[model samples]
Target chain A: MKDQNGFDELARQKLAERDFTFDPSHWTAMEGLLARPGRKRGAWWPWLAAGVLLVGGATIWITAREHDPAASVTNPGGGPRAIAGEVKGVNGSAAITEMENASYGNDHPGTMNADPAVPVTGETRATAGTMRGETSGEPRMRTEATRTRKEHGTGTSDRGTVTMQVNKIPVSSISVRQGEDPHAANVRTGEATNDVSSTMTGPGAAAVAGDGASDERSNLATGAVDPVRSDASAAPAGGGTHGEEQPDSVLQHQPPSAGTGPVVVAGSGDSASTGATAAPAPVDPVAAALVPPAWLAITAPYELTLLGGAFSTTGRYTGVDAESWPARTERQWTTDFGLEAVRNFGRHFAVGTGVHFSSYKERLITDEVSRTEQQLSTSYFWVAHDTMVTIVVGDTAINGATYHMTQLVPMTINELGVDTDTAYQTMVIRQRRSALNTVSYVELPLLLDAHTARGRWVFGLRGGPSVGLLTGRSGSLPDNSGEGYHTLNEVAFRELTVGWTARAYVRYRLSAGWSVGVEPTMRGQLFNSLRNADLDRRASAMGMMLSLSYRIQPTPQP
Target chain B: MINDHIIAGCVRQEPKAQYELYRALYPMMMAICTRYERDRQEAAATMNQGFLKILDNIGTRRKEVPVEPWARRIMINTVIDAHRRNKERKAMEGADIDDHAEGTSGINDYLKDMEAEAFAELLHRVPAMSRTVFNLYAIDGFSHAEIAGMLGLSEGTTKWHVSHARTVLRNAIAAEAMARTEKTVSR
Candidate 1:
C-alpha cells in the first residue's frame, strides 16, 4: 500500500510537468516573422501569391474597365473641337467679288475672281480652266493653283465645267443596325426616293469642295486661306452648296436641284459637289450640291481583349529521361516588363504579331556522384514574335449592357538574354551558347469590349494552343568532359514546340482613332524532346505587359 | 490569468494582449513558420503578416476560438500564395514522390527527454519544409489528407514527403542532442 502512494506521487509530478507555457521570447522571434509579409524563396507561397495577384489584378482590371461609362455618356465628341470655318459658301455676288480680286491681284491669297461670262462646255474629263498669267507673284501662284477642264468620257460632257480638286470623302448612311450581326441583311437603299443625293460634277468650269472634320481641336492657326471659301462660288444663305450635274447624275435620269439640293449617299460621306452642266443658268450651283441635315450619330465600338497576364507564359525548360541521372526540370520567368501587339482581320479570323523580352535563369545538378551540372539561362535581351487566329463566340457586358466582341491575333517574337554559369563538382564540364530562337506561332485573342458613353473598355482572357516552327536555331556548346550538351549537334531544343500561350488585357478606347491598354501574359513550351532525345520535357512561364495603340478610320458620317 | 492580460490579448490593437500574446506565442509560431517556410525572409514574412493579425484582433482571442489555428491559416495562405507565385512550381501530372528518398537515422524518440523550449529551438533550426512535415505528421496529429489539403497536393505526395521529412529530421536532431549531451558532460 505504501509503495502505491509513492507511485501515485510520481504520476502526479509527471502530470504537473505539463505547463502549456507560452514564451515571451516566442513573441520576439515571431515579431520579425509577423513583420514579414510572406515567406522567403518560398516553394509553397508562390501559388497563393499568384492567387492574390490574380484576384487583385482582375479587380483592378474590372475597375479600370468600369470607369469609362460614366465619363462618355453625354458627349460623343467629348474631346476638344478641332475644326473652324463658316458653314455657307458665297453666292453669285461673292463669286464676282472674288473674280475681281483675282484679276486685280490685291485680293487675299485665295479669292475667286474668274469672269462669270465664260462659256459653258460639259465634259467628263479632268477639268481645263484657262490659266491667267499675272505680272506680280500672285500670277505665278494662281497659275500653280489653276486647273483647266476640257472634255472626255462618254457623251455626258456639255454645258457644265467639271472642276476637280482635293476634297473630304463622305459616307452614305441608311438606318440603325439591328445588333452586332455583321452579316445582317442590308438595309434598303434610298433609291433617289427623296432626291437626297449630293451635287453632280458639271461639264464647264466646275468647283468641288470638302467638309473635313477632325478629332483633335487644332489650336495651331493656319497661314493659308480656308480652302472651303477659296472658290469664288458664293455660298447660299442656307450655309450649304450643291451642284446640278454630279457623278451620281450619270447613273440617274432626273434633273438635280439648283443650289439647295440635299447630300445623302449610302455608305460614303463624300461632300464634294460640282456644277459643270449649268450652262447659262445663273443659279448658285455650289449651294445646290451641299448635303442637308448633318448626321453625327454612331453606335459605340465594342471589344474584348485577353492579353497575357503574369500567369501566362511561352518558353519552357524541363528535364526528361536520363537513366544515369534523375530527370530534373526548371523554368525561367521574365522579371521586367513586357508588351503585345494585336491585329484583327475579318470577323472570326485574325492574325497578329508581338515582341516580348524577359530575364530567364535556372541551374541543374542531376548526378550527385558525377557532380555534373549547369546554369542554362540569361537575363539581357529576349523577344517573341507570334501570330494567331481566333473566333469570339460571346459578348462582353457592363451593368448588363452588351458590347461587341473584339477578337485579335498577334505574332509574338520573344527576345531573351542568354547566359550561363556552370561548375563541375567532381569532373570538368563544357558549355556553349544557344542561337537566338525566332519562333512563329498562331494564337486566338478573345476579348469582351464594352461600348459606353465614355468610349470602349475591354477585358478578357486571351489564349490558344499553337504550333511553333523555329525559324532560326544555330549555335554551339563545348564540353570539358567527353559528355557535354551541344547547342546544335549534341543538344538544344527541338525544331518545333507545341505549347499553350495566353494573356489578359484591359483597354479603354478614347475615340474611333485612339486607345490605351495594359496586359499580363503567361507562356510555356510544350513537351518537345530536347537534343533529339525521344523524351518530352515541357517548360512554362508567366508575367505582365502594357501598350498604347490607334485605329485607322475611313472618312465617315459618324 | 490577470484580467488585463487576458482582455488585452483578446482585443485587436490591445497592447497588453498583443505583448502577452506575442511573448507567449512567438517561439512556437516561429517554429511553425520556419517549419512550413522555404527561407527566413519568407518565414518572417508569413510570421509578420500573422503577427499583425494577432495585434489587430488580440481582443477577439479572449473568446473560444483557437489562436494557433487562426494564426496558422494566415501563414498557410502566405506560404501557398508565395508558392503559387513561383514560376517553377507548376502542376505536372506526375511528380515521383517515393523513388529517391534517402533513409534517415532514428531520432524522434528523444521528444520525451527534452523541454518544450529546447525542442522548439531545435525545431526552428531544422529546414522549414522538413520541420513542417514533421510537426504536421507527428505533433499536430494531421493526417495525409489534412496535410495534402493544406499544402495543395495529393495525399500520396503528402505522405511520401512526411515520411522523408521525418527521417531527415530524426537523423539531424539525434546528432544535435548527442552533441549537447557531450558538451554538458564535458562541462
Candidate 2:
C-alpha cells in the first residue's frame, strides 16, 4: 500500500512539473467563433423612403392637373398661357371705348341712341327730337330705337324726336334729313360692324372685361369720342329697322360683366359734353402684362410636405463601467418618413406639425455563451448465469426399490444480453457576436421654419421639439454578470422619449405650387433608452433629408 | 504567470490581451486536458472549451485568488463534466496478479525514470472509467468520496476502479521495462 502511495505521489509531482506541446490553431478556432458578421442590411432604408416620397409627389401633381376645372379655361394647350398680348382692352383707348359701348348696348338697349354722335348718359334715357345731317349731299335722319321692343316698351322710329348723351355727356339733339342713300348707309354700317366685332373677339377680352372693366377702364379712355361714335353707330345700324343685328349678336358672346365702370354726368350742351369728359389716359403695356391668371391671383398660405431621410446613428454611454459594456458602439444607417402640414405666418416664418415613423439602430459586440444538445448511442454487453431444472426418465426397471416414476436433474446455463442505449448531453460554447439593436418610434414633431426666398430658391433653418412613442424594439444587451447577453425585453426600456431635431434646408420651386428640398439634420435624445440600466445611453443621429412640398391654395370666395 | 494588467485587459475583452492570455496558459491547459482525453485533437478541443469558460467568468473572479489555480480548477471541472457526459461501462479486464507481484519493485523503479508522455501513454491503456477515477484520486488529489459523487458512483466502486487502473498501469510499465532490459542484453 505504501509503495502504491509513493508511486501516486511521484506521478503527481512529475505531471505537475511537466509542460505539454500546444497548437496555436486552437485560439484561431476560438476567435472564428467569436467574430460577428458586419451589419450592412439596413443601409438601403433611406433610399427607399426618398423613392416613395418622389413617387407620391408625382402622383399628386398629375392628379391635380387632371381634376383642375380652370386647366381647360386658362390653359387649353396644357401649357402656360401668355399674359401680355392676350389681355386686350387694357391699354388701347379705342379698345376700351368699343368694349364699353358693346357692353352697355347689349345689357341696356333702352338707353341706346340711333345717332352715333350721342352716347348713353344714364341707366334710363328719353329721346324726344329727330336729328338731321348731310354728308356728301346725302341727308341722314337720327332717331331713337329700342333694340328689344319688349324690354324698353318702345318701337323703332325713323323721324320721331329722341334725346341722347355722348360718353356720359348729355348733348343737344342733332337731326338728319330724310331720303338718305341706302348704299352709303349700308357701307358705313358694314365698317362699324367690323370694328365692334374685332374689339369684342380679341384675346383675353372675355377675362379682362369681366373684372378689368371696372378697374382697368378707370385708367383707359375717359372721353375718346371717335371710337365711341363708331361703336354707337354699329348699335343702330346693326339693330335698327334695317334688320342689321350682327354687331349686337357678337357683343352678346362676351363674358358677363363683373361690375359697372364709373359714369360721369354732365349738363345738356355741346360745350358741357366736351368739358366734363377728360382726355384719354396713356397706354401702359407693362402694367397690362403684369396681370396674373385668375387661378394665380389668390395667395395660398398652407403647405403640405412629404419628408424622408437616412441617418447614421450612435449612442453616448454613461453611469457604468465602459469596459464591462461595449467600449464603442458601431454607427449604423437608419431611416424615417412622414407627412407635415405647415401654416405660413408670412413669407419668412412658419409653424409645422405632423406624424412620423422613425427608427434608430445601434450595433453592439458582445460575448455570449450558448448550449447545444447532442445525442449519443452506446452499445454494451451483459453476462449472467442461471440455474435450470430438467426432468429425466430413470430406469423404471431398477427396482422395486422405489416407485420413482421421474427424477428432476439440475443444470447450469449462461445468458448474454446485448443492447444499445441512447442518451443526450449538452455542450456549451461561448462566442463573440454583434447584436443589432433597433428601436422604432412613431414621432410627432412641432417645428418652426424660417426662410428667405430668391427667384426659385429658398434657404431656411428649422428646429423643434419631438416626442416619440415606442412602437417596436429588438436586440440584446450584456447581462448583469457580463458573461453573456440577454434579450432586449429583459431590460427596462422607456415607453416614451423626448428629443430635439435641427436642420438647415435648401428648397427649389419646381412650379407655382410644387417644390423639392434637401435638408441636413441632427436629432438627439434627451434621456436614456433604458430605465435603471447599467449604462445610461442617449441615442443621436446625423442625416440628410429629402422633402417634397405643395402649396394648397384656398378656394376663391364667390 | 498572469498579472493584474493582463486580467484587466481580458476583462475588457481586448483581442491583444486575450491572445496573450491564451498563449500564456496553453501549455498548462493542454497538459491537463490530454490526461483525460484520448488524443491531442480531443484534448485541444476540450482545452478551448475550458478556456472560453475562463474568459467568460474572468471578470467575476475574486482579485485575492491566484488566477492560475482558479483557471486550473475550472479546467479540471470541465474535464470531469466531459467524462460524465460520455460515461459508458466497459467490461473489466483482469490483470495477472501473480506476475504483477514479482515485477512491482522493478515497475516502481521504471516509473521514476519514465517521461510524463510515456507515463500518460501507459495510463491511457486503462479503461475509461478506471482511468478517470485513478486520475482524480491519485494525480489530481481528489478524495474517493468526491470521485464517487462526480462520477455518480458509490465509494467502493470508485475505489475498485482506481485499484484496477493502478494494476493495469503497473503491468504495462513492467512489460515495457522488461522489453528494454531484453534489448540491452541482446545488444
Candidate 1 residue lDDT tens string, A1-558: 122223223322332344444544545665555456652222344456547555755674544333321121111111111111111111121001011000001111111212223322211112212112112211011111111211111111111111211011011111111111111111111111111111111212222221111001110110111111112221221122222222334223222211111122111112211121111112222322221111211222222222333333233222233333321223333343333344444222233443333322333323223444554554566766576746475788989999777567555757675666564445534332233322233322232222112125544445565444543333332232335544434455566565555555566666555566775555566566364453333546666656565554445576
Model 1: per-residue Cα lDDT at residue B150: 71
Q: Candidate 2 on A1-558: residue-level lDDT in tens?
A: 123647788777767766765566888886864463541122354456545544644454344333222221111111111111011111111111111222211222111122233322222222211222222222122322111110111112121111221122111111111111121111111111100011111110100000001111121111111111211221121122111222333223222221111122111212111111111112234332332233332257788989999999876555653345533467899998889898888556789888888888898765445565666666665565566565656545544654436655665565656676666665544357788888888888898886655446566767799998889888877765655667877877788899877777778877768889998777878888778656676888889899998999678589
Give all candidates' CA lDDT scores: 0.34, 0.52
How good is the docking of model 2, as DockQ? Answer: 0.18
Q: Pick the candidate with the highest TM-score.
A: 2
Where does model 2 exceed 4 Å of error? A1-5, A36-558, B89-103
Each candidate's chain B TM-score? Answer: 0.57, 0.90
